[model samples]
Every structure is written in C-alpha cells, then in structure tokens.
Target: MSEIATFAVGSLFPELIDKEADLNDWATEVERTLDLIPSVSRIEIDPPRGFMSFNLGDATEFKDLIQHAIPIGGEIRFHILIPARIQERIKGWSVSAGNSVEEFLVTIDLSTTYPCAFIIPLGEGVLRPSGAVIVVREFLTEELDKLGSKAAIKLTTLGPSPFHAEFHIKEGDVGEILAPGIRVSRAISSGYSRWTLHYDPEVHESAEAARTVIIQRLGYEFSTFYRIVAHRNIHRFGVAAIEAWVEGTLAFYGGKGLKSWIYRTAKLRKILHDISLEILKVQLGIEKVHKQNERLIEKARDRNSKLALEKELAEKAELGFRDELSSYAEMVGVLESRHSNTTQRLTSFAVSLLGVVVGALLTAALRK
Candidate 1:
C-alpha cells in the first residue's frame, strides 16, 4: 500500500492601509519584500490579470528547524504559482509535494482584495513516515513570521481568524471518517481546523475526485476569513463611534461647551462612514461564503460529507448577516437622529439670541 500525504496552510494577508496604492503597488511591494529572502531565486509578478510563479532557492540553512520523519533529498527547490480569480475563472491548481527530489512545485491561489490569503504547500518529504503535522505547521508558521519581520511584510504567524488547512491523503488507512472520502473537524476557539480528504487511488488516480471539493472549500475559507476581517473592522468602528458619542454627551454636561461637542460629533460622523463600509464588506463576505458552501454541498463525495457541510453551513447561518445589518443600521439611525436634534437646538438658540439683539436695538432707538 502506498500513501501520498501533502498539506498547505492558508492565512489572510493583512489589509495594507495605504489607500493611494493600487493592486500593482501592493503586489510589487510583496514581490520586493519576498525577494529579500536569500533563498528566493527568480520571481515573476502577475500581469494585469494573471499569476506569479518562482522557484525556491536552497534553504538548507533552515533545514535543521524542521524535524523530518524521513530524510529528504536535494536542496528543497520548490516552484510556487497562484491562479487568477480562482472561483470564477480558474478550475483550481494542483499543488503536489513534487514527483522527484529535484522537481517540487506548488500552486497557491490568492485573492487580490480583502480576506486575501497566502497558502504555502509542504513537500511530501516533510510529512512522510507519519510526521507530526501540527509541529510542521507550526514550523512553517514561525518561519513565515520571521520572514515577515526580516522583510518588513506582515505575513501571519498564526494567520488571521478562521485559518484553514487541508490534507490530501492518497494512500494509507484514513482513520475513522464521517463520510466515504472526507472528515471535517469542527473549528476551535481560534477558528482553526484541518479537514482531511482521503481518496481511493484505484477509483481516481491522482485523487482527482477531490478537485471540485478543494476549490469550493478553499473558496469557503477565503470568504470566512473575509467575513471575520470585516466583522472585526465593524467592531473597531463601532467602538470608536461609541467613545465619540459618550465623550460628546459628557463634555456638554461638564461645561466643556459647544467646541468639544462639535469636534466629537465630527469624529463620530467619520466613524459612522467607516462603519457603513465595514457593514457592506461583511454583507458581501457572507454572500460569498453562502454561495461557496452551497457548492460544497453539491460536490460532496458522500452523504455524511454533505451532511457535515450542511451542518457547518447551518451553524454559520446562525451568525445571521441580517441581524448584524439591522443592528448597524439602528446604531447609525440613532446617531443621525441625535445629530439632527442637536442641530435643531443650536438653530433655535441662535434665533433666540437674534431676538434679544433686536429687542435691545428697539429699546435704544426709543430712548434716543
């Protein structure tokens, strides 16, 4: 019996706060930073609508950090490629550990927008002879973090919330499964879990049965990451708005006068706009996840796998975008009403002051 095992870890790329820069600029910066690695040899930047692939140079210096269960050969030169717009345009990329010692290659799919992710595939050599998968995952994560610090790119150590990894096992006895071909673990507190796909090599040579499932699940992972990021942004803006509202109300009662109120009100308005954008982002994110989950259900290899996906989708549905939207809308409505009421009061006060001035003028004229 022969078993082929390979895995890849995915994480969200932090939102680059530079508003003025376009996609090209961001990609270029990533390219420049990654090039700083001594082991990275040739790099290709994706065209206006394409991908980048490059061969990994000799990384023997860091070989000691990885506890390999089986000895590896060659200098660990791996090729990496990303598919453009994976769901809509591409079928998905095959990322095997490599055929021979000298010909390792991996295809990583990345999104260009929020919830953008980076996947790093591990060679078969790294996971052979029953290696500790978690330890190797941690090893890669640590090295990525160090690379980020060394290159000034913010690649994740633990990755963003809802990080996902997938294992493809072509041979070997796949432990107990809830389905014919897959076993999905429930996400933990950190939103981390590894889903395994076991394929009978005889039925589908090269494990082609898992391709559609892979694309759909990867799509789900990306959407989940996006949703989390958007949700977090909403919280960030909501907190800012709350602080502004509280400060403004307290300042007015504490005799801080109109200046403080005006400043706080302006700040609150800006925060409200930010909150609105985040709300929209989350809405879009949820839609994507919903669609991908449906696709996963359709392509599920077995009854239990479909049921598991459905259950997961149902749990995700409990998050309820509608409720979130309503809550955010209510918060905005309350703030807007307060602003309107304050403006009306200010206008009335101004009119009353004008009346006092008119009365004084009339009295002075009469005296004259």
Candidate 2:
C-alpha cells in the first residue's frame, strides 16, 4: 500500500470529462488544492432570504444574479410560495405571507474533497468565511468577469467529474435540484428521478490521485510537527505548506480547481488551529528532553575537571631515577669532605701534647 501512490485510481471513479488531457489538468488542480485534510466542522452558507413578504427576499435577489451569470446552465429558485390569493375584492393576485427568516443556510461538509457546486447566472453573491461575513458576492462577480462565464457553483471537488450530490431546499413549496452538469430527462418513477451521466472515469481518478498526493503531504506535515503546540506558530508553517502544495498541484494540472481550493481553505482554517495546539504541546516536550541533555553535559564537565586535577598532581610528584641518583651522589661527596677535615685537626692536637710532655721530662732531670 505504501509503494503505490496512485494505486486506486481506476476503481470507484465517476465520468465527467472526455479528453485525458483535460481530465488530468482538472484532476491535478482539484486534488492538490482541496481534500488534503479532514476539516473538523461543517460550513454554512447563509444567504439573506426575506420571509412573510410574499416575495423572494434578499436571498432570491442574489440567487437571480447567480442564475444570470451562467450562460446556459441550470437555474435556482426558492419555492417560498405557491399560486397567490387576494382578499374578497378579487381585483388582483397577492402572494400569501409566510413566517420565515430572511436568510438561507447551505451547510457543507469539509472532510471529503468532494464538490458541492452551482452556477451564479444573475451575479451578486455575498459569500464569506468564518464568523465575519464578507462581501463575497462582489468579490466573486469581479473575478467571474475575468473567468468569462458568470456560471459558477460549489463542489466538494472538481476532479473526477460527475461528482454529484443532493442539497436541501432552503425555502421551497416543491422539490428542485440545482444541477450544472448533464442529467437525464427521465421522469420520476414512484418518487425518484434517475440522473444519468456520460463521463470519463480517468479524469476523476487523476483528480483524486492529485488530491491524494496533497493529503499525503498534509499527513507528513501534521505528523512531523505534531509536537508543536502554539497555533500562531503552526500557521507560520502549516498554512504555507498547504498553500504551496495546492499551488503546485494546480499548476501541474493547468490551474483548473482554484474555486474548490478556496472553498476548502475556508472550511479548514479552524481545524488547523485545534490540531495544531495538541501538536504544539507534543513538540514542547521534545525540547524539554533536549534541555535535560544539557544537564548531563554539565555533570560530565564536573567529573572531567576532578580527574584532570588528580592527573596534574601525579605528574608533579613523579620520581625520576636518573635525577634521584645524581642528587644522592652530590650529598655523599659533601659528607666525605667534612670527614677528612676532622681527622686532620685531631692529629695536629695529639702531636702538640706529646711535645709538651717531653719538655717536662727534661726539666725534671735537670732538677735531679
């Protein structure tokens, strides 16, 4: 399993693209940019949908803008009210008021690199991420002009085409689907409509493969820095690694899956914060181990100093045979010289006493 990087490509693939080149291009970008990590939370798209006005409110207006953006894609409509009715006058029609909030919530799961997409034909979308609501509609409109088509939709992934899903109807009186890709015209049998697709499996596989590569990189990073505790520091490395991998993969596949990449990033930013804290603590412990090593070095230095002092004393006190013998010879010579001087003095004193005794004997004979 470790040997095969793209082992499971051909299996469980969906059809979407025709040409291998196009599929690969799309796949590589989508994979590299998105699906690297499993996000911890769900994403919510809150569009202001006014209620009780008998009218499609702010959310409907923005939905209209997105619809116009798509050249020939499918459409989106909120079935807020059915055919309306008026008072007893019977003059004209009036939309019956309903009690509902003015915002639409679209919940997205961040774990899969899968795609949840639709086209914005009419234009305005105020999409934002995090607790802060951003001016997403204006931001996308400007970018869409450069991209040529106003048609856009969200997807868990763009790789491996035919990545399909069903979303909840925000405010509807009837069931509807916002599908951008090809679907069959078969009528619902019993209660279900069969949507068919003619797609290339390789494109899906290639894109999935690219996503696998990016995810592997993320795993490597998460595991490698699992010990790092601080969220701020983790961002310094983690965010950059994610960005680099995403960019490289996209570039390799011809820059196709940029939209999915943005959506995925928006979803995962907080997950990184949570996991990073756990990892930061782990890394801090490792550093503490390194500090213990320094203490061991200190102990070793103290031991070496004591041994050095003992060695120095032994060298200073060592007795050399040649030098010791010479010192002994010098002491013996001085002792022998003093012995000869004492012998000469004793002999001179004895001779002088004998001379005095002979003179006394001569004086005694003269007296007799």
Candidate 3:
C-alpha cells in the first residue's frame, strides 16, 4: 500500500511583482528554492505531457533554453524527481523518527496553483504518513520563510494541504500569522470526524472529491500535530505516534468497512442533525405564532365583551329615557285638562252678571 503526503506553498510574488520582467528572477528563485530541499536527485522543468526529462544545470541555462518555450505571462511548473535511494533514506529517517515504516517515496511539486508546492510521500501500510509530511512541511516552511524574508517577498497560504492556511507578510517579510487556521481546522476536523463514521475503502477509490477532502483533513491534522509536538517538545514519537493513534482510532471506529458505511452512517447523522435543528426552529416558530394568535384571540374577545357591555348600557339608558318622557307628558296632559274646566266656568259666571246689570238699566229708563 503506497501512502503519500503533500506540502504546498502558494501566492508567492517577487519584490518587483511583474511576471513579465521578473521571469528570470522568478525562475532563479524557484531553482534556488528547489536546491534548498535535500534528496532532490533530478529536476525536470517543463517536461512533455505525461513524460519527464531534465537537461538544465543552472537558472541561466534553463532561462536561455526555455525562455522561448514559455509564453509571455504564462505559468511555470517544476517536477522534482527523487531517486529510490533517497526515498529509502527518507523512509529510514521516518522510521527512526518513530514511524513503523521501512519504505516510502517522496515527490515535490512546484507549480503556479494556489498551493505552489506539494511535498508528497508515497508508500503502503505506512504506519506514520504524517511524520514524513511534518518533516517536509517544517523544512519547506523554514526555507521559504527565510528566502521570502531575504527577498522582501510575501509567501501566503503556505502549508501541506489546501486548507486556506496563509503566512502573513508585513514590512516586506513573512509574518508569524497562520490565516484561516480556525476556520480550516474546524472544516477539516468536521470532515475527518464525519469520514470516520462512514468511510468505505471502495468509495474512497471512486470518490475523488471525498478522498481529497479527507486527505486534506489528514494533512491538516499532521501539521497541527507537528506544531503541538514542536511546542511541547515532551511527547515521544511525536507526529508518528499521533498519526498512528489517530489512524488506529479511525480504523477501529469505522469497523467492517462497508462501501456505503460512510455515506450511510455519516451522511445520515448529518442529515438527522440538520433535520433535528430545523424541527427545533420550526417548533419554536410554531410556539411563537401560537402565542401571538392566543394574544390576538384574547384581545378580540376582550374588545367584543367591552362592546357588548356598552351596548347593554346604551339600551338600558334608552329605555329609562323613554319612560321618563312618557311620565312627564302624562302630567302635562292632566294640568291642561284642569285649566280648560276653570276657564269655562269663569266665562259663564261673567255672562250672567252682565245680563242682570242690563235688566236694571232698562227699568230705570221706563220710570223716567
């Protein structure tokens, strides 16, 4: 079983920052960087597709021979070929470093991609892939940091995996900042944990994206373990021990590795978790809406009850007013009847008095 570890450095720009004018310098820097790495027995620049050959000895030789070969403002890639003997040496070193591995192959790739460089160690049943990865990562980081600092160039996003971890640059030098550490670590850890629950070896063969994500997570863990070991300086076997422990734990937990285990178990867990959260949110929303509706119903009932009470009062007041008016009209009618009777009596009495006076006057006139 061949195992591979990768280290990548990206977004490196020359002080001049002009790809066209700085082509020569860039090539020189790339060559110099490659030279810093040990066990690089051969280097092939711009090999034919699917084939590799090396001829250049120095930057000038490569520049003169391949200047016309590369187009203007085009990208450059270097394929480093390490001999089997060198790989054996690395394997020996890894085993000496506490890994239970006797053989592995290491390959370094320098390209124009986001991860400009990839350090890959390939082997089978390699007990500690991460040990080899960390060694190379440290070496590459140190060399790149030194070179970048000297040239006043900034090397951003330098790491073994494409987890978006970056090296900050300040004052034309690489700063001690690992950008995207928190976010990338979280994503990688979550991915690895999910994969542990559901990983299938057959699925890994076909699922390139899934494999890449898982491998990147592994690389991230490797780097993190390296940092922790280097910081504490107390752990025995360091990265190798950590890698073995992590891999063993995953393999044990994965159990009877079915092809659909990862997809079935991890994905189902994620789905169920998501659904549970959504249900919780929905239930909360329902409760909120229910409470609001209850409040509205209570307000409506209160308003209706108030209106009913007011209506009842108005009806009672109306009846009372009507009764009072009827009573007052009846009293006035009785007074008018009494006044008419008195007036009739007085008129009859006055008429009788006038008749007596007229009769007495007529008698006096006859006697005269």
Candidate 4:
C-alpha cells in the first residue's frame, strides 16, 4: 500500500441547492476563492443527431431547477474555521505519512451552492481500500462527541457514512489506488469504489487542476441520484394520466354522460401531453450535462488517469444514464399509444351520439 500525503472527507446532499437567498448568502471571502470553479453555461456538449432540443419553458420557472438546461454545482460556498472547543480536543491530530507525520487541516466548509456537501481534511494514512472510510469514521466519532448529536445533525445532514472521499496520493498508480479489492468487490459489487485518487500537493495548491474531474464526478453522482427521483416523478404522473384516461373511457359507456365523458377525456389528453413534454425536456437537459462529462474524461492528465476515469464512466455512468433515459422513453411510448387508442374511442362515441340525437329530434318533429 502507498502512503497518502493528504486526503479530504466529504458528503453529498441528496437535495439540489437552488434557492436564490441561499445562493446570495454565500460568504464573500469563500465565494471569491470558489469563483475559480468553472460555470455550467460556459461548458457545452453538442448533442448527436436526433437529439433535437426542446423548450425549457420560462426562465423564471427553471432558473433554480436542474431543468434549466445547464449543469450547475461543484464548488464551495460557505466555510468556517475550526471552532475553539473542537480545536482544543483535536488540536494536534496527525497521521503518519510514511516516515513523517502530517498535521490535519480541521476546518469545515459547508459547500452549499453546487455539489452541496460538507468537506474537511482527514490528514494522512496508508492508502488502503478502506483507508478513507476508517479515518472518516474516527473523525466523525470524535466530532460527534464534541458537536453533540443534535447540533451536529442540525448543522449538516452528515450521516454515519459519506457519499464519497478523495484520496490524494503523492506517488503510486492512480488506477491501482482506485481498484477495488476482491473481497470488497464481492461485498459491494465490482468496478464501483466510493473513494477516488487525484494528484496531491497540486490539488492542494489549486483545486483548479482537478476541477473538471470533480465537477464531472459530482455530475455523475447527482445525475444518478436524479434519475431515481425522476423515475418516481414520471411514474407517478404516468399512473395518474392513465387512471384519468380509464375513468374517462368508462364515463363514455354511461348513458346521459356525453358531456362528462368529453370533459374528462379532454383533461386526460392534456395531462398526458404535459407529462410527455416534461419527460422529454428532462431527458434533453440530462444528455447535455452528460455530454460535458464525456469531454471532461479526455482532460485527465495521463493515460492512467484517463483509463481510470473511462472505467468509472463506463461502469457507473454512461450506461446508467442511458438506462434511465431508455426507461423514460419507454414510458412515453406507452402513454402515446394509450392516447391514440383513447382518441379513436372518443371519435366512435362522438359519431354514435350524433346519430342518436338526430334520430330522436326527427322522430319528435314527425309525431308533432
């Protein structure tokens, strides 16, 4: 195992940070330093043929949402130096860096704007498969003692586990550092390790070098998280739309219910149309962000870095994205087919109703 020079521990917040007040409330000093991270708009990825664009609706509506057609997040927004009480307990915390010792930087930054997470330095350790996890556990245990359960939970939503960790190694092949052990792979599945390796000292000097990678990594995480939530959202809407169509179709079979049937069917059609459009818009936005990630993969410093990134992207990213998109597309197709069948039924109902009304009117006039 190689000795880690320095490392950082952080967690991901499942929710997107999009409130204007939260965005505007960033500490100026922290914001100035973080302004170095790239903007989502400046990064662009050309969609392949047939990936036609759709309207993102009004700016006001999508401005703070992911549906705004841009990939935003991956920067620090708020931070505070270590508190005196906590500092006293862990003041001299250090971990071995081969023959030497490296002091920990124990400040906490509540990264709020994009890629929302809590970040702190975890000092140095032997870069093993579970090295980061072990260090973070000890660190959090001590922190929980100092901060107290209520306060710690209130300040940040950090749990017993972190979403991911960044291991900074001064030497060794990054690919190997990132590789999962046989036992760990069997336990958690292969090709998906939560810790990542990036060049050290350099990352400390200016995180700019690792910006693309960091953004893309967070992008992949957030997108994957989003896909699950999106599936639920689409599924909920699809089910409701289908229910409406079914109810409307049944109403048509009831006598003296022509107007009610027409109204319900029209409403169902509108709901189906709206949900289908929403699915497409989300798909478009996700594709654009993922394309940017593809470009970022090529920016890796060496062949090893590139290979590591490509492996991660292939194993955990691209397919996941396509799977989510394909699922959404399938839902759309099913809904569209239901809509077509419902329309044909509505047409038949309308024609038969017209015939019945006309015959009754003619019969009444002859009797008069």
lDDT by residue for model 3 (70-100), tens: 2123233333333433344543235444444
Local accuracy of candidate 2 as per-residue lDDT tens digits, 289-316: 3444334333433433322112222322
The true-versus-predicted C-alpha distance at residue 149 of model 1, in Å, is: 14
Local distance difference test scores for all models: 0.42, 0.26, 0.34, 0.38
Worst 10 residues of 1 by lDDT: 66-75
Assess every candidate by TM-score. Answer: 0.42, 0.14, 0.26, 0.44
Tell me how candidate 4 scores on lDDT: 0.38
By lDDT, the better pick of 1 and 4 is 1
> For residues 97-141, what per-residue lDDT tens digits would candidate 1 score against the true structure?
222121223222343222233232333443321112223233333
Tens digit per residue, CA lDDT, model 4, 158-231: 22223333334333224333322100011223432444344344333433334324443443333333332332
How much lDDT does candidate 1 score? Answer: 0.42
Instruction: Show the lowest summed lDDT stretch of 10 residues, model 3.
Output: 166-175
- The whole-model C-alpha lDDT of candidate 2 against the native structure comes to 0.26
Ranking by lDDT: 1, 4, 3, 2
Off by over 4 Å in 4: 1-103, 106-264, 301-308, 314-321
Quote the positional error of residue 368 for candidate 4 in Å: 4.5
